[model samples]
Target: MAIIIAGWIDLDVEDVTDIIASAKAHIDGAYTENGCIHYIWTKDVFVPGRIHVYEEWSETADLQYHFDNHWYKDMGGHLRQFPRKGSQIRKFRVDLIEPVYDPSGTPRADFFTAK
Candidate 1:
């Protein structure tokens, strides 16, 4: 099943401009991984020193492989340079997948593919 790794990190580095700049290469490298569907790290508009992270992998095993990959390791080390108050990252196992809109473009809350 596909999985999502999502959360936020609060840091002591008031401005994360340099951190984000340095992470671009590593972030791009992660996208080259076969299992990566989407990966991103962006700043929270209303919060200073906060970076939001989101990553989706084809499967749990793929995410495990990423943990040992150079891209992940490099990003970890790069971010380690800055002081952080805490982080709340978590891995989510997906149960079902569906689009928010149907053919008519109306919003939907029920799972069309599972039933």
Candidate 2:
């Protein structure tokens, strides 16, 4: 099972390009780290200044390594320069991973939670 971390980060800045550029080094470094499955930061096309972050690690130890890395600290410092409007991040322990699109060409909603 892999550990999944995903979230949204809303910045006060009007443009997210500079922020992304500043963190590029750290992002790249993260990809080279051990047990890193995926680490991505993407801008919201519909909402400027909004950035989405997603990460997956093979184990908790790997995620802990990321938390203690100097690059991670540096990235945090760079991001602090831009005031944040709001942010939300969550970690999940995934037991099973599946694609939303099935082999039969049907979209599956098996993971939906009823309200």
Candidate 3:
């Protein structure tokens, strides 16, 4: 099963641009790793200091490999350079994935669960 990781990082800086710039290399490097389906860091438009992160891996082993990578090791130091209010990252094991939109541009009700 694939693993999906997602969360937001609240930065202390006035803007997330510089932080993104500094982390660009690390983010780009992730794409070359095995089982990296997607890895992204995006700034929240409504909140200036917030950064949203999303990642997908083929399996738990792949995610573990990411944790053991040098870039992941260096990320902590790089992030600490800029003060941050806080951050959260969570992982979910996906048993199934379905498209939300059908070919005809209609919503697929079966793809989502009701609250």
Candidate 4:
């Protein structure tokens, strides 16, 4: 099963843009790292100053390296500015995922025959 990580963050007005920018930059820079299948950052549409992070890693070592090097080691000061109000991080294995069709490709009901 793949690893899934979700985190919620609330930021002060001053740090809102900075927090989002940093997260975007980090993901863009790190997505090709050994175990990173997905690293998406999202802002809460309805809630002001709220951010959500989603990560999928190949293994525990890959995730540990990311936290230790990217967030904890390199971004300590930058991350400290964000408020921890009611924030939480959760981790789990993915049991299943629905497949998505590639619309740009030829339209075939069967994925294998699409090409």
Give one clash count per candidate, in the order shown.
0, 0, 0, 0
TM-score of each: 0.92, 0.87, 0.89, 0.68
Give me the runs in candidate 1 sitting further than 4 Å from their true place.
none
Instruction: Arrange candidates, best lDDT first.
Output: 1, 2, 3, 4
Question: lDDT tens digits, residues 72-110, model 1?
Answer: 999999999999988999999998888899878989898
Residue by residue across 3-101, what tens digits does model 3's lDDT show? 999999998877898788889889888888899999888989888799898999999998999999977777767888878898898999998787788
In model 1, the Cα lDDT at residue 103 comes to: 76
State which candidate has the highest lDDT: 1
Error of 1 at 84 (Å): 0.3
Give candidates' CA RMSD values in order: 1.2, 3.6, 3.0, 5.2
Of the candidates numbered 2 and 3, which has the greater lDDT value? 2
* Candidate 2: Cα lDDT at 88: 96
Cα lDDT tens digits, model 2, 1-115, are: 6999999999997789878877898899999889899989888888889999999999999999989998678878888988899999999998777778776868888843322
Evaluate model 2: give its TM-score: 0.87
